[model samples]
Target chain A: MLVIVMTSIDPLTLVLAIGTPLYLAAAVLYSIRAVRGPTIPDIILAVDCLSYDLAVFLSAIALYYKTPFMTAPPIMLALWVYLLDIYASKYLITREVGV
Target chain B: MIEQVLFWTGSALFIIGGVFDLLGSIGLLRFPSFYVRLHAATIGAIYGAVLPLIGISLIALGSPGIPGNYTIAGASFVTALILLVVAPMGSHVLAHAAHKSKSVSWKPFVDMLEEDEEK
Candidate 1:
């Protein structure tokens, strides 16, 4: 007879287990706001939150998989989202992309 | 001992970040206006995202089981720092744009910017 007993869980695993679901829930709520928001700023705000959250999630996933190369994407995503904010605001204010 | 300390501390931070994320998202959904929702987005950005990235960095540093733990830690830490700086700037720019464009529907009692503009 073979018996497998699970005694202890890895701390990182435990943290990931508890944290990921919460992030997912937050993402879903933000998505709802993005869809239903009446104004463009409201939608942009929701997307901003979503992208930041996604960066966190991606980093955590990279840690989980022990893939160091994967960490690069989160930083890129964050930078690009910042660009999105700047470009969108520029367009909103000037009503044109080029000044 | 150090590994254990890092692991536990990181875990605690990770959990707190998760709670903040949930709260911020709820606030985003329930807030009455776009301007008000900016507060919620700030919460989500600083508390929910940056904190967890820092926590992930700590966890990566502590976990010797991860193959390239140093790389993961460094990357996450840099990402957190970038987010800390970028998030608020983005929020400020967006709010300014929204206000200038008069995209906000709700009127505040103060209207300091409008008053200044008029003067």
Candidate 2:
């Protein structure tokens, strides 16, 4: 997908060219925090940051491809992260997520 | 003319958001403590995710090549909307959970929550 976006010489192409690498770099930094984090919550925070970034990256890809259907991924990604946060918080508070 | 303007606007937003994403990520790496890293992560979630979604939606809405359907634009809008609503709340929950679990210490310079927790 990125290759296709990069081959084109349009404004949207420019946006994707710049955005893709930046998002990847963010993910790298988040991963570092996740792996080296001193506490479980710190690792969870890194993952939360990483997922949000993935949603943004997906939106950029959708724009580059001009595919509306692609937008669905970001929505689902955000929703999933939110669910993760809820369960994580539940676990942190009570050590159980009720299932 | 309008399309060009919208495209450039979207481009600008994407650029700014990308810069923020990079900075936030660097902050995540450099911060001294878990709470500080959380601050950096929150910045990435809100600015990095939301702005680019809006920018992409604008580009999608204005471009002629990619179908430019209203549903597509609407989907991007919804994604951005959901991110805006969810990111902060998720961060807050994580912070609360971290505090409650004693997974990370509250070592801020002021330490207000520390006193409240004791009370």
Candidate 3:
């Protein structure tokens, strides 16, 4: 009885737990958009959104786990996304010629 | 005791919101045009990501057993607020960017961005 009670997730933890999978789903959706977007800006924007999302989702998971370590991956995720956006924007400006 | 109830309720909201978000994604995949796809993306972020974040906060806030310092609930709640404010702005930025870039043309309808572009 003690083991069952202690080991079972409290209702709140269960709630926090669901966020990881949902983040996974959203990440996939954003990726799909990034891949399939017809234009340069669309893809860049999708990538941007995905990166921001990974950051926030990572933070949330960190809170759930009560761990400071969960924070690191998202910071890196955001940096990578920002880098991609700058690259994509520069490419769009130079390559896409005209009205 | 109360935490258990609140957690379940928040989770239910999260699931419902997720479904709405999923619907929005499907709309994006299925929609015929860019403008329409914009609608799907915006709605998905709003309904799916933002709403679930709020639900998670509620669950955290309501959960018991944390000492009175309020860090657990407070931080989680703050996270929801940030998402709520930022999500819409992000949507607006993407939609505006997409509209202004003149990358995709809408079909069989009146278009304002085009008018602006023409000027």
Q: What is the C-alpha local distance difference test score of each model?
A: 0.90, 0.80, 0.59
- Name the TM-score of candidate 2: 0.89
Query: Each model's number of backbone clashes?
Result: 0, 0, 0
TM-scores of the models, in the order given:
0.94, 0.89, 0.68
Candidate 3: which docking quality band?
A: acceptable
DockQ of each: 0.56, 0.57, 0.24
Candidate 1 local lDDT, B1-119, one digit each (tens): 99888977887888899999999999999999988899999999999999999998888878877678899999999999999999999999999999898877986888888889999
Q: Which has the better lDDT: candidate 2, or candidate 3?
A: 2
Worst 10 residues of 2 chain A by lDDT: A1-10
Per-residue lDDT for B1-108 in model 3, tens only?
Answer: 676677677678666666666676666667767666667766665676566655655555565443331454455455545555655555555456556555656665
The DockQ value obtained for model 2 is: 0.57
TM-score of chain A of 3: 0.64
Worst-scoring 10-residue span by lDDT in model 2 chain B: B64-73
Model 2, residue A55: C-alpha shift (Å): 0.6
What is candidate 3's DockQ?
0.24
lDDT value, residue B28 of candidate 3: 62
Which ranges in model 2 have alpha carbons more than 4 Å from their true place? A1-9, B106-110
